[model samples]
Target: MKKISFIGMTLLFIACTPIRNTNIKTNLLDNNTFELSEISTDATYGTEKNPIQVGGVASNEGPKNERRFLNALAGPNGEAVTYFRAGSCCPIKSKNDPFGSGSVMLDNYRVTWQGAKDTVSIYINMYDSGTLKAPKGFTIKK
Candidate 1:
């Protein structure tokens, strides 16, 4: 009975523990945006539905973080990029969701360049901080 109770408590503790957000301390620039320096090679990096996981801005700064990530990207050939919020979708399991919903929905953005005929869609999860990078077929700002 004692072992069973201990095991049950351990499981509960693990389930409720939130991931630490100590990874991006050095990557942020003045709280205005993130300083991304690499482009993602994984095709699924940005195409894996509406959860790009490209940044971490916590709950209050979620929208701002999404914009900062988009601002860091350029077209395949370094063309000027423009984007707008496409709305929120995809509830990803996250420890950073402040609402205690156990998950956070990602923000979708439709990005386009001056000469591009079609827009690229990216899902962003600002609640969870991940390695920030530009999606494939895109470039990062210098």
Candidate 2:
């Protein structure tokens, strides 16, 4: 009876343990493409004092794009990185020409660098212009 109880407890403990994703080393957004206007970094995660945000329009190419972009970022020591979509801001609208144009599609992402002790939250905004630029303190490569 005691042997069976011990085995059951062990199984329960194992099952309850959370699993971490390890195989996140490939470009998930290989097919999807978008031009990044600016990239910014903030020390605070999410707080009133130092809000986390990006400049320009925020937009997403959908789930595939988000996954690909997040996976492509490397940690300080080239570690694998994972990300989750935190939220988004209101979409801006513009009207003038036949096709109607607007700017600022901001998207927020919470990025985690596997094997690293710190995590970062960033925002990616897709602008109408086909240009990519990094903010004063941040840099991005495509």
Candidate 3:
């Protein structure tokens, strides 16, 4: 009974552990990288006042690669920004597209920076022509 309990506990621990993918390469426009001090996905999207989104399918990149690329963006004042995977964008059917010829997946991420006064939201596009770089007026940590 004790052995069984130990095995069950070990399995539970492993199952509950969060896995971090270290093999993903950073693919920001300028090779920019940022340390995530805090991250959350509890925000709305597509609203009139706070309309921020980002991301789309890359030719040879998957969601994991896209996330790694986005992890490198910093806040306006160099504060750690939060990422929210809002959803996908319009669908495109192209037989020659790398992301499968039937549907083009565009990922939308709502990036937010919590400042002293208030929170700011920025929209990002990860479509075919999406570029991974800090938006205008925003700065990433060197």
- Clashing residue pairs found in predicted model 1: 52-123
Which tens-of-lDDT digit does each residue in 64-110 have in candidate 3?
44465456656768777777776766555433345465655455666
TM-score of 3: 0.45
State which candidate, 1 or 2, has the greater lDDT: 1
- Rate residue 27 of model 3 by lDDT: 43
Cα lDDT over the full model 2:
0.45
TM-score, every prediction: 0.77, 0.41, 0.45
Q: Quote model 2's TM-score.
A: 0.41
Return the TM-score for candidate 1, rounded to 2 decimals.
Answer: 0.77
Cα misplacement distance, residue 101 of candidate 3 (Å): 3.9
| Model 2: residues with Cα > 4 Å off, grouped in runs | 1-29, 32-63, 90-103, 127-142
Q: Where does model 1 exceed 4 Å of error? A: 1-23, 26-33, 48-50, 54-59
lDDT, model 3: 0.49
Candidate 1 overall Cα lDDT vs. reference?
0.75
Best by lDDT: 1
Model 2, 65-139: lDDT tens digits are: 444444445555555556677787645542211234543345667766656565566655333221223322333
